[model samples]
Target: MIHQSFLDLDYCARVSGCETCRTFRRAFILEQITGRDVEFLTNPDLQSPVYAVLRIESSGDRLLLTSTPTQKPSFAATVALNHEPRHLANDPTKSGARLTTDFQELRRVVRDCHDNHECSSRYRWSRRNPTWLLEIMDNNQVRLVRGPKSLVDYVVLSYSWGDPAEMPAAEWARIKGAGTKTRNGIPVPERLNPFSAWDLPETMRDAIDITKELGFGYLWVDNVCIPKGTNWDTEASLMHEVYGNAAFTLVASSSSKATDRMIKERLAWSHRSKAVKLRGKWLHNTQMPLDKIRLESPVARRSWTLQEERLSPRVLYWTEQRWYWSCPESQVAELEELGHVRPENKSMERRSPQLFLELCRTGDIEQLHEEWLDIVEAYTPRDLVEPRDRFLAIAGLAVRFYSAKSEAGGSFISEEYLAGLWRDNFARHLAWSVAKGANSRHNLQHIAPSWSWASLPLRMETKTKHAFKPSEHFRFISVVEEKEDSEKAMTGPNFTSHDSLSRGRTMEERGRGVKVVDVEGRFRRFVSDNAKQVSWDAIEWRRGKRVGFDFGAFPGHDLFARHEADGRIIAKDAHSGEIVGQLDYVVPDEALKSPFTPYVPCGGEKEIMCLELGESAMLLLVRNPSWGHQESYRRVGVAISYENRKGFFYGCETRTVRLA
Candidate 1:
């Protein structure tokens, strides 16, 4: 017997698996698993929409699964109804109506996670004194005064700085004049008066409002927190600790510009697909996926915020539609209706801060490689207001990762930092490429070595399938670059890891390449077809190569892709005439050096320069003897060749090609 009709349904969105949805959807889900397709959903003549909202009268959090009376959902079909009301009469005041970032709900969510979660406590680090902090409630930037308060629990803000040039002249001038502003390229750090809240940007003011509402006294806004100086490079070193030790971070995900408001009116309905009703009621609104909600934002696309997001143990993300709080174990919202549905881990790498940190703590070396690759994918493809900060932006993360593994009881103590690539199976990280259809370019500032992904600005291809193995276990993988360890705190590297390089050589075969360790104990990367022996351009190889390359129209040199893309570029062996191996990226022709054809070994015509940090394809060689770094190469693009052990760069002399 059915006790409930599951009426009063709304917001049947793409990512909106709301509370009512789960219970109402249970009937449709079960029927599909055991019965036939839902007729109302598939009926052609109806041309009407179906919407459901589940209502349960239970004392406990869970539904009444086993009861004296059995219950299930009931569905009814009906036609469209126009003039649906959004109920925009009263002031929202961040209420349950729009799933606002209201304080009462935020407090409840925070209290619940703290009281019930284990990971919340374990994910924290020992508290430390913040370098410099903003008094959110007050309009002052002050250091620790003569008081017993040494360790302060501060809230941090992560937001897009927007284009400095376009900022209000008064605000930008005040910021620069306040102290050495990082964005305005102020190279000199000097003693200056503290800036008032009135001088700060709108986002910062909003963040301050949020911090104050959360009952925090001190706030850390990058530009304001750091003492005014061009020498901030040294001060930047403590960023990891600054964020790691914060009480929590407020991320303005929806704001693309500093002037834009973080909190805005919510869009509850869709205009794209017309609203048809079920049982002559309930409107339709597709749910946005959690990943899109987190990543598809202006702040998410900025490179510098990566460190801020990853290091903070707890974060309150303000997306376009609603507010979400994420900790080690859970990502919850303030919507009261959401209380009906239990949120489960979707296994999104960036969704959980502890995902990679846990790997470091447990000394999971093999898993760390894949996680780092994901970080690279997420970091690159983002637009940097000042490209010079490329390496500097991610330097904190590199330092944090290294520090984690080098702790007293950690693994890979021998792991060395070579530019952005790790020392272990250093060859595997060498395989990187712009996402298919994306483009790559040299960092005019030349912030990193040619061999390092830091040397370029490009969107790295995001890898979904796990093909990563312990590089120690691989035989053909390899680099030695004299890297500048996190400059006090930053760098300029745009890099990413592609799919698992072709299956590793047999245990014995992996060691086929030469091994030369100088005093540094670094492995030599075999140089493939160094100037003379290039066979990629050979007529035989060209004849065997067939093109399925989609390098022109992929999703905008994007970073942090959905689990949707797997672009394949295949290479063939003229001898076998068989579709043999995969190539991750091909530098387009415009970047190719003279005398080199697309078939000659690099990206096809339009031949853009590239670098290969090989796990999969053989890509661009980025080196310039002219820069005075002998035998050093700049990566034009990253590529890896798999399956065919003797592909383009196969069987070559092992040499350490320091990428610029």
Candidate 2:
């Protein structure tokens, strides 16, 4: 829990405190700046017998008033200084004084502090001489003086001089930016290059030289190259480029020469001779028990026996090189079959700077190259690049590790093949899927389709302007027309009139839209031929009822009713034994209706219902004279109308949902 404290401004003002009490009070006031606790003492300064008025001398430049003090009033006190502003009152020497110069308050303080003997006398001569020569002038214009020697002294005072010499300016500055700026007397370098060099340990000097000779212009040597002050942005950016551009990164294994020798002579040799054996019955073929095979037979003499089968050979191969096992494929399997106590080696799970540095010192660039290659080969490019791009490096690394395991376990597919597979699977389909995936993650609540498509890795078509190709991997399938393989096909009608109208620029612009799917099963086109139509049941909610079929709620409500020649209502209501209305007339597929009508309904209960035409035509409930809301309802139910167009809006679909 967070704690708080109260500031007794009244008590402080009455205290007529001395320097010590004043200091305590000042600290207390400052603590109040952040609404925190602070302790004050009225008798903190026992040395002085004067009972001076002690109060917060300044609060945003005004004194915090409290009870008056009983101390003898001197000329300084009687000056009414406390009644003036804080700046005027605080300085007894120049209370209420004003300057005509352009100097701001801070500069004024600096000038005052410099001119006042009391302030100037506070600084002491350095016991340790200044590294920088002094450049001082007593002119009134002069305040504080610092020279080159002082600069060097400042650097030295802030940093240490280790066994190594001064660091480059860029590196030192980098460290400073990284919030780890060190005190070592190091000059920060300003620029970085691939050819940058560092002071390597005497033992690794040769290795360092080799790296330079190999054309590495910018090298990252952690010890001397990365400054203690490197900024986070620069560090993060550099991390990517450093890991990618390095021809080979050198790892330091040991800090001392003696430890290096020990690793090579004693540790390396013992690890090389160790081995593991497999003695399981599976080694002898479990179906053919060892006892069943006759040892005396000539076949047995030439063929492998139980003893030979059980003896799985494994020889550590590290003596020839560094610390790494190099067992043959056969023995590797035997090691696994034995279970738990197989070949032993140090874990390579953690990244080791020491190990890396050791490799660098030994000039094992080849090993570094091979190991890096192994890492890349084991992980798919998508697995590596996508995660990296998305700021999910940790997850990416885990995926890479798993990929490595699969490769090591004898999978025939390479990382390259996996990348190719991803491309092939998603190439044609990525456009919509990628957008949808990102959108799904952006939603504030659970949305339709009830599935997250983002993680599915759906491929999109390269472009929407051209026809789709079989070579393309995936395409976004709209729920209504996803199974169809052709370009935006419309079922039911030609919509020759609508051909001139441009679809809205985007799905959002279309509002509640519709998708036009080609429902014509199998037929050839002829101008005189009747427009094809696929029969499907459309379920709708009835108006003024709990639920059930009615077309009044659909967009463009008075559709079939008034438009029919035999305009009338049909169907019984569920709640009450009354006609629900509908099916008064039906529009045939033959006659074409006017495509454009200025008489669009304003979508209110009082608007005139649409006029319908043709057999089994849809019905509508038109008022006696089409008036206002209060005098409503003569008919209601399924109302279909005649129109040549198929789709109503862009993203919206007109398809019926299957109840089965």
Candidate 3:
């Protein structure tokens, strides 16, 4: 009979070579079960503990036994001895026997029998697909088995254990050792691909030896040599590498020069459009007080907050080539992706005739020597020509040369864009001269040549005294410098004011056949006999105020409005104080002996001429004008000073009038 604990290693070790194994052997034989049983083995010399194994019979009934005796070998002490002799009569360890023991040991015996059969070499079909090829015993390790050859590849057992994929590709290659990939016989160096544009400057240096010598490494211009077919995404990704990496950019200012010539040709092909019709257009009067006209409306300066291309001309150099009047960097990236190369080597690039004419006078004579000869050949000096004329003529040529390039398919930058770029770049210069206040604005006039206008009339010589002057038709607004040195301060006003009360007019051309009407009331305003209102007294000009006048007496009368005949009027602020000063407008006629003659007096007459003016668009002091004391006008309401000599008086000139 078999014991319930027959397969237990410790229990088997106590029984294998002892009387229990002999008893089990006899019992299994009596039952005639398949297989022989094996005894347990122990290494006595190695001092290793014991484990059990089985010896199978010819029919495969396995006999489990221990090599050592349990409790020093006593047949009567065996677990099977407790069963009665009758239990042994049926051979209880066997399923068909009448004698019975626990089912647990019996099931193990059956399972082991099946396992031995399946793993047996004679069962060759099992080799077709092995089951225990890989074994994950637990989280600590994995065991890969190939039958009896159980090999465990422990990743943690090796030194190189962390994630290798996270390492840089270059580092990976280095660790892997350098090797060349052969296409046919040609060997290509193995490398982790880098962005192409990052290497553009280096490529250019290798290609153009001359550029490499000219400090081109810092600002390489590749547009001339690099094909525009490169992918844009790659180019855009390399923007910081291209622009930020470079010291400065080279711009090709001549692209539009050729284009301008083409434009002229196109204009020639098409009929000319009619000139725009504008009324009441006349030259500004020199006799008009600067303080009065100082408040006149001016055309707005150009706006460039979000300009994509430079309005003014700027150059960028790269790749031994030059990109003239280049578009903004943001736009350039898009173009670069389109495969258009930027230009470079601008110091040697071809100059358009117009650009040569314009910028030729800007540099030193020695630096401009090459262009000097060309200028001398193109234009001859006129009689009594000012130095400015000579400079302008040379500058004109340069401008035309550059402009013509733009007219072609070149990247012609807009003049406005160029101007704005120059201004932003030279903002420090502006900050430097903000002092001298309004007079400092005059300093900006020299840079005016940068703003080239195609519509301005050009002539070789002027027949009139003012012939050499800027266009009289277009009033070039400038700040009139006041005696107050407030402009010298660092934080002084960026603007200037011409005070009518502090100065008076002095001009030789105050025409006769004109009558002046002082429109100074609680709201001080000024108007002429046949002209509109010109000046507004900030204090006197208020909402719901009116000044009426008569114009029927004058003949061939064209009213010269000083402030408001045709323009709209609206009170800018509320009125609350005593009417100390007034703003007035008048309709003056040329028939009057002198336009300066005042039609209103402060103390002499209670019926003073008052022409109510508009405050809708009047240019006022950058700061609110606060004349300390509120009092009656001394001589004439307030004197309109002519101040500077330019030309004719209009709706916004200053005039002197008596204040009561």
Overall lDDT per candidate, in order of appearance: 0.47, 0.22, 0.22
Worst 10 residues of 1 by lDDT: 499-508
Q: Model 1: per-residue lDDT, tens digit, 356-458? A: 6566556667777777877877877677767666656765566666655555333324555555666664656656544452323343324555345554454
TM-score of each: 0.62, 0.18, 0.17
> Top model by lDDT, which number?
1
**lDDT of residue 239 for candidate 3:** 25
* TM-score ranking, high to low: 1, 2, 3
Q: After superposition, how far is residue 481 of candidate 2 from its true place, in Å?
A: 26
The predictions' CA RMSDs to the true structure, in order, are: 13.7, 33.4, 42.8
Measured by TM-score, the strongest candidate is 1
Q: What lDDT does candidate 3 reach at residue 15?
A: 44
Number of the candidate with higher lDDT, 1 or 2: 1
Candidate closer to the true structure by TM-score (higher is better), 1 or 2: 1
What TM-score quantifies how close candidate 3 is to the native fold?
Answer: 0.17
**What TM-score does structure 2 among the candidates reach?**
0.18
lDDT of 2 by residue, 154-173 (tens): 10000111111245555444
lDDT of 2 at 543: 62
